[model samples]
Target: MPTTNDELPESGRKITVTEAVRLTTNWRTYLDDSECDFQTKAFLIPIASIKNLLAINPDAEGVRAYIGLNDADDAMSGKLVLVPVVDGEDVIFLPGSNGDPDVENDSNVYDRSQNCPPDCSTPNELNP
Candidate 1:
């Protein structure tokens, strides 16, 4: 059976700092071992975009991020697409799909998160 909205928690669970560090460290180690050019350490999504996604529906519980590559041919161009989650299901807005004209500001999916390397933050335990 599928997880119902009522069965889901109101919010996500939290993790401790130690656990967070371990997860990040594991990812870093994997990236190093893989020796790939796409060394994306992190993605920075603006708060405005999040707000916009949330504003799409009043009942939105949260946002779900789907890892994606901007260009299928370019592995370095990795990206994350965010969609609003309502009742445990992704709420993707597809305006004007029924023969009507597309409206501006009718989109719910968001991308363009600043990736690390060029837009990385100052040296920190997570980014270092």
Candidate 2:
């Protein structure tokens, strides 16, 4: 059973082509319905970054994605913030460069992902 999001399964499941297409189609519908002009279809995150985030806590179950905006007033500046999740909850990191585990801070999160548009996949079934 999935501990965090009820929408997600216990583990990664392989879906059929039809299912994949349906999911993508639904996502597209959402973008259109929401009037998302800057339809950011995907984000490119480095594997090393993910590894580093996971290294912060050996018991990390997974990384949670948070919708962010560079400029809170601008919806066009949409971005994805990644945070390590432990025990079905986000792990708040320490404040400052010292990286002390005791001190808690909300700013301690990852957002190295490149949003699609200028940085995107070569028109695949998912991003088409």
Candidate 3:
């Protein structure tokens, strides 16, 4: 079944327009099934728009966004889904013709705060 945007919960934290854009554009897959195809370009617009909406309000914590396929189309449709995570146990199903999208949450969303400067964590950083 396709998840409607109305079904998704609103974020509790206020996300900056810039941060939201970054989130979608720089989205890293925490987990992806081999079969699910990512429509990178197609999804970028919706991802950015949704992020912008979330950014308006701060304090919406634990909110993650993802782009998944609709069963009807294998191509990326730019459908942005707002996924909420609880203690990292949210199960997400990727839109597919067959099996439901795999579910995984919070524990999967990347933490930007922990990102270290290039030189701090990598040997290349030290050399550079």
lDDT of 3 by residue, 1-128 (tens): 42554555564345565776565444433213334454242222335544643454233345565644344464443344654444564423222323333433212222222111211333331212
Better of 1 and 2 by lDDT: 1
Q: What 10-residue stretch in candidate 2 is worst by lDDT?
A: 99-108
Q: What TM-score does model 2 achieve against the real structure?
A: 0.73
Q: TM-score for each prediction? A: 0.76, 0.73, 0.26
- Model 1, position 34, has a per-residue lDDT of 97
Sort the candidates on TM-score, descending order.
1, 2, 3
Runs off by more than 4 Å, candidate 1: 1-13, 94-106
Candidate 2 C-alpha error for residue 97, in Å: 9.0
Model 2 stretches astray by more than 4 angstroms: 1-10, 94-108
What CA root-mean-square deviation does each model show from the true structure? Answer: 6.3, 6.1, 15.9
lDDT (C-alpha, whole model) for all candidates: 0.75, 0.73, 0.39
Error of 3 at 23 (Å): 11
Residues 29-127 of candidate 1 have per-residue lDDT tens digits of 998999977788889999888776666666887788888887888766778899888879876664354423364355567896877756888987777
Q: How close to the true structure is residue 120 of candidate 2, measured as C-alpha lDDT? A: 79
Error of 3 at 52 (Å): 13
RMSD of 1: 6.3
